[model samples]
Each structure stands twice: as structure tokens, then as C-alpha cells.
Target: MNKIKVMQVVTTDKLSGAEKVVLDIENNLDKDRFEALALCAGGELKDLYEKSGIKTYVADLSSLKPGEIKKFRSYLKENPVDILHGHDVKASIGAYIASKGLGIPVISHLHSSYPWLQGASPLKYIDRFYRKKYKLSIACSHMVKEHYLNYNKAVSEDNMKVLNNSFNFNELKEKVILPKKEMRSRLNIKENAFVFGFLGRLLDIKGADLLIDTFNKISKDIPESLLVIVGDGPEREKLESMVKNYGLDHKVLFEGYQKDVYSYLNLFDCFILPSKLEGLPMAVLEAMAMRVPVISTPVAGVKTLIKDGFNGIILKERDEANLYEAMIKVHSSEDNRVALAENAYKYLVENYNIDIYMGKLQKIYEGIR
Candidate 1:
């Protein structure tokens, strides 16, 4: 039997949720039955994938260069693939354009809601047109599916699948074996300090500024509290400025983007994701799998995973005051934190295991083929 050739395309090789999903699929997909290859604009992701012995193609995806598209099309024509799997809007557009008249099935995964493009725009219509060409549209959450459906009326329910994001629990368990005390000491954090961690892109959509403001408000009350933000983005300068303005330079630490996030997760007492919008964030799941208590706004698929005061804490609003109160409530009692973390770990093991995710994804691919 011929193996199913799948070409996974992405905008960049950055350590983001969608990129990580693509990486996981490429690494773990059935090697005997599936031929998985990754195509992206060269970056750290490319290096990581190549190091893992996965084949990758680097193309300029930042702009719609005709030469780039022609080169990609020529390669696909010569070495045909059974499917073109795209991870982001840009990659979806590129795949749709490149695979035109090639008779190849294209599957585009929607990872987040695009609220900024709510109103009228030429790019919106163009994107919608290209999105409709996808044979399957895998949404990371129900909210993500709704966002695309609202924008692109041409997409039918038959083509859209709401497959929640997942994490490798066994791998995570192995990575978190380092002693918490050692990790904290490395970061210069005291043993007794209440460390609150936020890991994601420092974008306005992620609400890192809101988290900073909330941390600033509560830092005065909690003497030994620290806010450690992981990941880097365009909003770093602005966030750093806010920390400086609030005189929180001493209390807050920006670790930037560390490849080994599990080590940092071990150091966190509580994990917070204050995103204005999200699509089943993998960071929250990773923290939960690492047994770190999570506090996040009830947005996207978060409401599905967390019941307030049950498995995890959910902020009612996106404002700093609400987030600050939630943070304090979780910080006030160690018992509550442990209980939440326990429940979260149980929930992760039961539902969001990577093995289950890969099974469902394989079924989807087989069904489409």
C-alpha cells in the first residue's frame, strides 16, 4: 500500500501553539503509513524539526511572492502529496493558492479567533475565499470554529471539526522532574515567594498588559509575590515600560522565550493566562499537566475545561481588578491551590492526552483520504 503523503505548512518555525501542534503531528504520526513533511519560513522551528530528523522546506511565507509560490507549486507538482495541511491563516492561503488545480486535499487548522478583523476589509474576504477551498477545517476549539463561520459563510459544518488542543503528559511528567527549589534558586526567587507565571506571546490579544497591571495592583499587598512572564512578542517593550512605571521591575521577571518551558513550569506556584481571546491554549494545559494551578479568563474552550472554584479558577472579567482579585483568592490559601492543581492534573490525564489527540487526527486524515 502507498503511504499517505502529508505536507504540513506554517508561516514560521516559532514556538507558538499552532506551530507546536504541527511539530507534534510531524514527530508522532505513523511513520509506516504516513509520509509527513513540514514546510515553513525558516526559523527556530525549522532547526528543531530538522534536529528531530523530519524533512522540512523553507519558503518565504511572510509575503505573497509569485516566485516563492511558483517554486512551491513546482516542487508539489514533481513530488506530489496526498494532503496539504496548513496551520495558520497565512499558510492556509498559501496552500489554497499553490494547490489550485492540483487535486490535492488541503486541511487548514484554525488556532484562534480573529476579533480584530470583525469589520469590513478586503483581506477578510480574500481569506474567506481561500478558507472555503479547504477540504477540512480543524478548529482548536468551538469558539475558533464560530469565528471562522461568522466570517466565512461559505464553510459548512461538514467540513469543520472542533478538535481541542492536547499535550504529551508522559513527556511533560518527565520534564518536570527537576526540583522546584533548584529551579527557583536559578531564577533568584525566594523559596517562600508566591510565583505567578504567564507563558504566551506578549500581544494585546493575549492580555499580557492586563496581567501586568493586575500583578502591579496586587504586588503591594503580597510582599513576597513575583510575576514571571515567559515568551516574547511585539508588546515586550510596552509591557516592560508598564512594569517600570508601576515600580514592579524588582517584582516582575521577563524570561523571554525559553525552549525548555517544562523547567519553568516546575518553578511556578500558579499559572495564569489572561487572554482577551483564546482557542484552547496549550500553555494552560501544559501547566495543568505539570500540576500547576491555573487561573484564566473564561474565554473560548477554557469554559469547557474549567468550572469556577472546581478544577481551576476562572476570572469573570478581563479587567485588572477582576484578575487581581482572582490571583489573591488563589494565593490566599495553599490548600485551595493544591486542590485545584490536583483536579486539573486529573482532568488533563482523563481528557487532553496527546495519544487521544493523535488517534482522532489519524482518523480524520484516513476519513478524508
Candidate 2:
């Protein structure tokens, strides 16, 4: 039997959610039935993919010169891949144009509700034309799907499918021992600290600044408190400024993009996500799997994964008072935190297991026939 050949394309260099999802699929899929190839914009992920024994391609996916398009066309002609998957706006355009005459079906996936109107983005009708050309559409969240289907007049709701991002949940039994004190010692986080960890690509919509404001409001009373943010993005410098302005330098730690995030996840007592909107964030899911309680804004896909005050705390919105109140409630009671953690672990094991996700994803790919 011939293996299914999947070539994936993405435009960013960061370890954003979409890149991670693509890598996870490549890492977990059945080797006998599938061979995944990756094409990404220049970044650390590109190097990692290439080093992992996968045939990886790197190109300027932002603006394709005719020469670049011709080169891509040559590669596709030679490879004759079974499926072409595009990960973001620029890559989606590159892919649609590259697959023009190959008769190869294209699958374009949207992991976030991209601000398509900003930054010289083509109008919704124009993107709808691209959508119509693709064989399949994957929206990373149900909300992301609705955003496209409802706003884009030309988008056929039936053309899109909603699939939450999947992760490598191969539960590590002999866990890497990251003592809270040792992790704190390295970061100067106090031993008895109440740390509210926020991990994700730092964006305005991610509500990092709101977290900073909330931390400021309560840090004096909760003297043994610390806020650690893990991940980097366009908003880092601005976030750093806010941390400085708020005098949270002593209590807030900005640890940038970590490759070993699971290890980092172990150091937290609870995870806080204050996104204005979210698909199911893998960061929250990781915290859940690692047995850390989560507090997040009530958003579309998040409400699906977290039952309020059960496995996690759902805030009314990104307001500082609401986030502060939720964290204070969790921090005030160890019993509540422990109960939420246990429930989160159980939820992750039952719903987000690696085998279960691969079974579903493989079924989707096989449906192409």
C-alpha cells in the first residue's frame, strides 16, 4: 500500500499554535500510512523540523516572487504529493496559486480568527474566492469557523470543518522532577510564592497587560506572589514596559518562548489565560494535563473544555477586577485548586488523549478519497 504524502505550509517562524499543531500531527501520525513533509517560513521551527529527519522546505511565504512560485511548482511537480495543506494567510495564497494546475486538492486551515481587514489583507470576498478554490477548509475552533462563515459573504458554511488542535498526550509516567523551589530559585521566585503563570504567544488579545494590571492590584496583600509569563511575540517589549511601570519587576518574570514548556508547566500552581477570544488553547489543555488549575476568560471553545469552577475558573471578561477576583478566589483556597486540578487531569485523559486525536485526524485525512 502506498503511503499518503502530506506537505504542509506555514508563514511564521515562531512556535505559535498552528505550527505546533502541524508538528504534532507529523510526530504522532502512523508512519506506515503517512509521510508528512513541512514547508515553513524561516525560524527555529524550520531548523527543528529539518533536523527531525523530515524533508522540510523554507521559503518567503509572505510575498512570493514569480521565481519562488516557479520553484515551488517544480518541487510539487517532482514530489506529486497526495495532499497540500496551508497553515496561514500568506501560505494559503502561495498554496492556492502553486496547486493551480496540479489537480492536487488543497486544505487551508485557520487556527485563529485572523484580523484579515488589517495590514493590507485582501477583502473578505477575495479570500472567499480562495476558499471556494480549496477542496477542504479546517477552522481550529468552532468560533473561528463561525467568524469566517458568517462574516465572509462568499464562504460556504459546509466547506469548513471545525477541529480542535491536538497535542502529544503520551502521558509521561516518570515525570521530570522540577521542584517548585528549584524552579523558583532559578527565576528568583520566592519559595512560598503564589505564582499565576500565563503561557502563550504574548498578544494584545491574549490579555497579558490585563494580567499585569490584576497582579499589580493584589501583589502587596499577597506578598508572596509572582507572575511568570512564558512565550514571546510582537507584544513583548510593550509588556515589559508595563511590568516595569507597575513595579512588578520583583514579582513578575517574563520567560520567553520555551521549547520544553511541559517542564515549565510543572512549576506553576495555577495557569491564567485572559484572551479576548480563543480557540481551545493548548496551553490551558497542557496545564490541565499537568494537573494545574486554569483560570480563563469565558470564550467560545474554552467554555467547551472547561466547566466553570469545575476543572477551571471562567472569568466574565478580561477586566482586571474579574481576573483578580478569580485568582484571589483560587489562591485563597488550596482545596478549590486541588479539586480543579484533579478534575482537569481527568478531563484531559478522557477527551484529549493522543490516540483518540490521531484516530479522528486520520479519519479526516482518509476521507479525502
Candidate 3:
């Protein structure tokens, strides 16, 4: 039997959640059964994929240009892909166009509930058309699947499937061997200080500003508490300014983007994600797998994983006051934090392990082939 050629397409070269999923699939797919290739815009993601021994093709897929489509179609004609797995709207559209009438199966993976294609008024209908053309659509979460079904009545339940976001727990366990004391020491954090960590893009939708405000509102109350934000993005300057204006320079530390996120997760007493929108965030699962306590908003598929005060803490509301209250409640209780962390770790081990995700994904690829 010949190995199935699976070409994964992503819109951006940034190492965001969606891009990470593409990498995860390529890294873990059965080498004996499949040959993985990545089609993406040129950036760190492309370089990383190439470094990981996966063949990658880079192109500007921001818009639907005839020349760009033609070039991509020409490449596809020569290489002959068995399956075109697109990670986002742009890549999905490009793949649909390039693979048309080629007898190739196109699978669109939905990583977010609100895709960029749906935001564009003129291109909103394109989502329906392109999704209909796809042989299968994989949603990162049930909520994401529901969003697509709601948007396009023509899409049937059998056409859409939920493959929740997962983490490489075995890989993470090896990386998290760093001691908490050593990690905190490197950051100049006090040994006894309660640290709340946030890791994700600094964007409005990610609630970076909301996090800053929530931290500021409760910083004075929890004097020994510190907020450390990992990762950087468009709203970094604005978030930093807000922190400075609120005189939280000493309480909050911005570590920017660290490739070794597990090391930082070890240092955290709690991981916070106050995003306004999400499609089952990878950061939350990573934190959970690292046995770090988590407090996040009830967005997208978050509610499916977090059972409010059980497995993890869920912010009832997205405002500063609500967040401040939740923070105070979690900060005041050490036993509560430990319980949540333990439960979250057990939950991930049981449900969201990478092996489970790989099995489901491979079955989809095999079925399509």
C-alpha cells in the first residue's frame, strides 16, 4: 500500500494556536501510513516545520489573487496531494480552488468560531460555498462545529466533526522537569509569592486589556500575588501602557514569547486566560497537563473541559469586577488551587491526550483517502 500524501495548509506563518495544531498533526502523524507536507505563508512556522523534517511550501495566501492561485494550483498539479487539509479560511479557500476537479479530498479544519472569512461582509458567503465543497470539516471544538452548522444550514451533521484541541502530554512531561524554585529564581520572583501566569497573543479578542484591568483591580488586595504575561502581539504596547498607568510595574511582569512554555508553566501557581473568544484554547490544556491551576472565562469549548470550581475555575463574567472577585477567591485558598490543578491534570490525562487526537485525525485522513 502506498503512503497517503497529506498536505496541511495554514494561512499564517505565526506560531499561534491554529499553526501549532498543524505542527502537532505533522509531528505525530503515522510515518508508515502517511507523508505530511505543510503549505503556509512564509514565517517562523514554515521554518519550524522544515526544521522538524516536514516538507513545507510557502505562499502569500492573505487574499484570493488569480496569479497566486494559479501558482499554487500548478504546484499541486505537479506534486499530487492525496488530501488537502486546510487549517483556516484562507487556506481552505485556496485549497478548494487549487484542488477543484482534481479528484482530491479537501478537509477544512476549523480552529476558531469566528473566522476572518465570516467577518468580511462580502466574503461571508464564501465560507458556505467553500465548506460545502470540502469533503470533511474538522472543528477544534463542539462549539466551533455548532457555529459552522448555525452559519450554513446546507452543512449536514455528518459533514462536520469535532476533534477537540489536545496537548502532547508525554513531550510536555519531559520538558517540565525544571524545578519551580529554579524557574521562579530566574525571573526574580519571590519564593513565597503567588504567581498568576497568562500565555497567549496580546490581542483585544484575547482580553489582554481585560486581564490588565482585572490584575490592577486586585493587585493591592493580594500583595504577594504577581501577574506574569507570556507571549506578545498587537496589543502589547497598549497593555504595557495600561499596566504602567495603573502603577502595576512591580506586580506584573511581561516575559514576551518563550519557546519553552513548559518551563514557565512550572513556575506558575495559577494560569489565567480571560479571552473573549476561543476554540478550545491550547494554552489551557498545556497548563492543565503541567498540573498548573487554571482560571478562565467560559468561552467556546472551555465549559466542556472546565467544570467551574471543579476541574478548574471559570469566570462567570468577563468584566474587571467579576475577574477580580474570582482571582481573590482563588488566591485566598491554597487547597482549592491544589484540588483544581489535580483534577485538571487527571482530566487531560484521561480525555485530551495527544494520542487520542492523533488516532481520530488519522482515521479521518484514512477515510478520506
Candidate 4:
């Protein structure tokens, strides 16, 4: 039997939610039945892909200029794949245009509901056209699928599948090499400290500033509190400046762009995601998997994963006061934190296991080809 060839195309070089999903599929696909390759728009993720022994192609996907599209098309001509699995809008459209005459099926994996995708916009129409051209669309969450469907008249329920971001709990267990005490000691955090963690790219839309503001509001009261931020992006410098301005140099720690996030996740008692927008955040899912309680804004995909005061606390609004209150409520009691964390872990095990995800993904790949 011939192995099916899949080329996972992504627009960014950073290892974020969508990129992680791409890596998961490329790394864990059945080796006997599939040959997985990656086409990264040139970033740290490309190097990691090559390091993992996967054939990787680097190209500029920042623009859909004729030259950029030609570069991609040229590569496909020299090394064709059975399927072009594009993560997000840019790569999906780029792959569709590049594979124009090749007759290879394209699959658009919608990982987030970008601002333009939420409502009718000129770019939304362009996305719809390419999405319709693709053989299938895999939304990272049901909310993401609804976002696309609510605004556009292109793809329908029949062509879209909601594949929530999944977790391999065992994989996480393997990555946590340090005990929580040792991890805290390394970060210089006191053993009695109530640690709140935020992980994900430090971007404007991620609402890192809001978290800082909320923490600042309550920092003096909770003298034994610490906020550790993981991940880096364009917004890091600005966020760091804000923390400095608030005189929170000691209270807040920024550990930029970690390759292994489990060690950091291990130190978190509570994970906060105050994202202004999202599809389904991988950070929140990781927090849940690691048995850390979550407090997040009710954004896209989050509404699906969290029920307020249930598995996690969903902020009614995105503001310093709301987030500040939520934090205080969780920090006020040990039982409250444990109950939320355990419920979140239960939900993750029941719905977001990686084994089930791969089985569903295999069917999608086989059916598409």
C-alpha cells in the first residue's frame, strides 16, 4: 500500500496554537500509512521540524505576491504531496493558489476566528473563496466553525469539522522533569507564594496588559503572590515596560518563549488567559491538563470549554475589575482552586485526548485523499 503524503503548511514561524496542532499531526501521524512533511513560512518552528527528522520547506508566506506564490508552486512541482493541509487563512489560500494545476486536494484548518473572519469584510470574502475551493475545513472549535458560517455563505456544516485542540496527558507527564518545589526555587519564587501564570504569545489581542493591571490592583494585598508570564511576541517589550512602570519588577516574571512549557506549567497554581479573542486557546487547555485551575475571559472557543464557576471561571467581561475579582475569589480558598482544577482535568480527559484526535484526523486525511 502506498503511503499518503501530507504537507502541513503554516504562515508563522512561531510555535503557537495552530503551529502546535500542525506539529502534533506531523509528528504523530501513522508512519506506515503516511508521510508527513512541513512547509513553514520560516521561523523557529521550521528548525524544530527539521530537527525532528521531517522534510521541511521554508518559504515567505507573508505576502501572496506572484513571486511568493510562484516559489511555493515551484516547490510543489518538484516534490508533490497527496494533500496540502494548510493551517489558518493565509496558508490555506497560499496553498490553494500554489497547487492550482496540480489537482491535489487542499484542507483549510481554521484555528482561530481572526477579527476579519468574525463579520463581513473584504478579506472575509477572499477567505471564503479559498475556503470553498478547499476540499474540507477543520475548525479548531465549534465556535470557530460558527464564526465562519455566521458571516459567510460559502462553506456549510457538511464541509466543516470541529476538531478541538487535544492533549496527550502522558506527553505532559514526561516533559515535567522538575518537581514543583525545584521549579519554584529555580524561578526564585517562595514556597508559600500563590503563583498565577499566563502562557501564550504576548500580543495585544492576548490582553496581557489587562492581566498586569488586574494583578497590580491586588498585588499589595496578596503579599505572597507572584505572576509568571511565559511566551514572547511583539508585545513583550511593551508589557514589560508596563510591569516596570507599576513597580512590579519583583512580583512579575517574564520567561520568554520556552521550548518546553511543561516545566513552567508545573509552577502554576492558577492559569489566566485574558485574551480579547481566540479560537480555542491551547494555553488554557494545557493549564487544565496540568491540573491548574483557569480564569479566562469568555472569548471564542472559551465559551465552549468553560462553564462559569464550573470547570473554570469565565469572566463576564474583559476588564481589570472583573479579572481582579475572579483572581481574588480563586485565591481566597484552596478548595475552590482544587475543585476547578480537578473538574477541568476530568473534562480534558473525556473530550480532548490526543489518541481520539489522531483517529479523527486520520479519517479526515483518508477521506480527503
Best-fitting candidate, scored by lDDT: 4
TM for every model, in the order presented, reads 0.96, 0.93, 0.95, 0.95
Query: Which window of ten consecutive residues has the lowest lDDT sum in model 1?
Result: 169-178
Ranking by lDDT: 4, 3, 1, 2
What lDDT score belongs to each candidate, Candidate 1 first? Answer: 0.86, 0.80, 0.86, 0.88
TM-score of 2: 0.93
Q: What is the lDDT of candidate 3?
A: 0.86
Clash tally for model 4:
0
Model 3: residue 52 alpha-carbon error in angstroms = 1.9
C-alpha positional error of residue 345 in candidate 3 after TM-score superposition, expressed in Å:
0.7
On lDDT, the stronger of 1 and 2 is 1
User: What is the Å distance of residue 170 in model 3 from its true position?
Assistant: 3.2
- What is the C-alpha lDDT profile of model 3 across 1-369, one tens digit per residue? 899999998877778788888888888999999998988888887888998889999776778777877888899889998999988787899988988888889998888777543464656677776777889998999988887777667777898889999988656645536789998888899998989889998988898788888888677787898999999988999999999999999999999977888888888988989998888998998899888888898788898989998989888888888788888888888899899999999999899989999999999899988
lDDT tens digits by residue: candidate 2, 180-234: 7778788776668888898999888887888888889879778888888999989
Model 2 stretches astray by more than 4 angstroms: 64-67, 117-123, 171-177
Highest TM-score scorer: 1
Q: What's the TM for model 4?
A: 0.95
Task: List CA RMSD, all candidates.
Answer: 1.5, 2.2, 1.8, 1.7
